[model samples]
Target: MNVLLFGASGMIGQGVLRECLLDDRVESVVAVVRKPLGFTHPKLREVVHEDFTDFSSLAGEFKAVDACFFCLGISSARKSEEEYRRITYDYTLAAARALPSNPSLTFTYVSGEGTDSTESGRSMWARVKGRTENDLLAMPFHAYMFRPGYIQPLHGATSRTRAYRLLYVGVSWLYPLLRRVIPKHVTTTENLGRAMLAVAGAGGAGEHILYSPEINRLAAEGR
Candidate 1:
């Protein structure tokens, strides 16, 4: 399978990219980024593009793509709604629109656990994410929304956000206990990556929106 990946430098993206590279079924990975990932693999191809709102020039890269892992996102903390919406909604929609209208294409989006599907919610991020999810589901491709809560970054994957990094550092030792206590609310980067691949390869089954428990189950099934 040929894959197109966004936010390959991010923590979740890093895990997905690693899994894609390791999977024998994956032929190649085209990662779109503003800067190089600095990590090289024979199957990895990096495309440096500055503007996420417009992807017209990168049309060639979108051709013949079997799956797209849209992991690009930003924390809403300390940012205006407009800024968050631009990155979350606008960039995602632009990429979706840029891809060819193929039903065979599997488009997986990484949303948070509390994302609103109704497009109307008390939380600003949830509402925007809901609208994005709703719009993507309406698209022609086989779209899947993954909502993972309390993700444990495995295999050296780390968040770029300082606060998130600190939080992970403080909570890393408690992950095992947390998983045992609340397995449904927790997942790992490895599990999330494998789950995406499993859903894509299966042509999307069960539910369009998968929570952490479903994500973990899919990962195990894939293995």
Candidate 2:
């Protein structure tokens, strides 16, 4: 299967990209990024794109793509709602629109756990993500939304954001305990990637929105 990946440099994206490369089922991976990934893989292809709002020039890259892992996202910490919406809603929709209108194609978007599908929520990021999810589901392709919480970065995968990195480092020692105590709400980057592949391979069947428990189940089933 040919896979199209976005946000390949991010923490979650890195894990997903690693799994795609390791899995023999995946033939090739095309990663869209603003800068080079600085590494080479036999099955990996990097496409540098500066403008996230427009993906018209990358239309050819989506051709014959069986699955697309849209992991692009940003923290809404201090940014205004407008800035967050631009990256959260606008960029995601642009990519979804750019893909071929093939019903067989699987498009998995990485959203957080508390994302509001109502599109009217107290949280700005959740509202924008909710709208993005709603719009993508309405598209022709087979789409699924992933809502993972407390993802443990495995195999050296680290977040690009400094605050996240620090948090992960501080919490790394407690992840095992957390996992045992709250298995349903916790998952690893490895499992997340595997789950995405599993859903895509299943032709986007089952639940449209997956949480950590469901994600882990899918990963195990895929294995």
Global lDDT of each candidate: 0.94, 0.93
RMSD after CA superposition, every candidate: 0.7, 0.8
Candidate 1: segments with Cα more than 4 A from true spot:
none
Q: Please give, for residues 126-217, the per-residue lDDT of candidate 1 as tens digits.
A: 99999999999999989999999999999999999999999999999999999999999999999989988998898756698999999999
TM-score of each: 0.98, 0.98
Name model 2 segments beyond 4 Å from true.
none
Error of 1 at 60 (Å): 0.6
Q: How close is candidate 1 to the true structure, as a TM-score?
A: 0.98
Tell me how far candidate 1 lies from the true structure as C-alpha RMSD in angstroms: 0.7
User: Candidate 1: what lDDT?
Assistant: 0.94
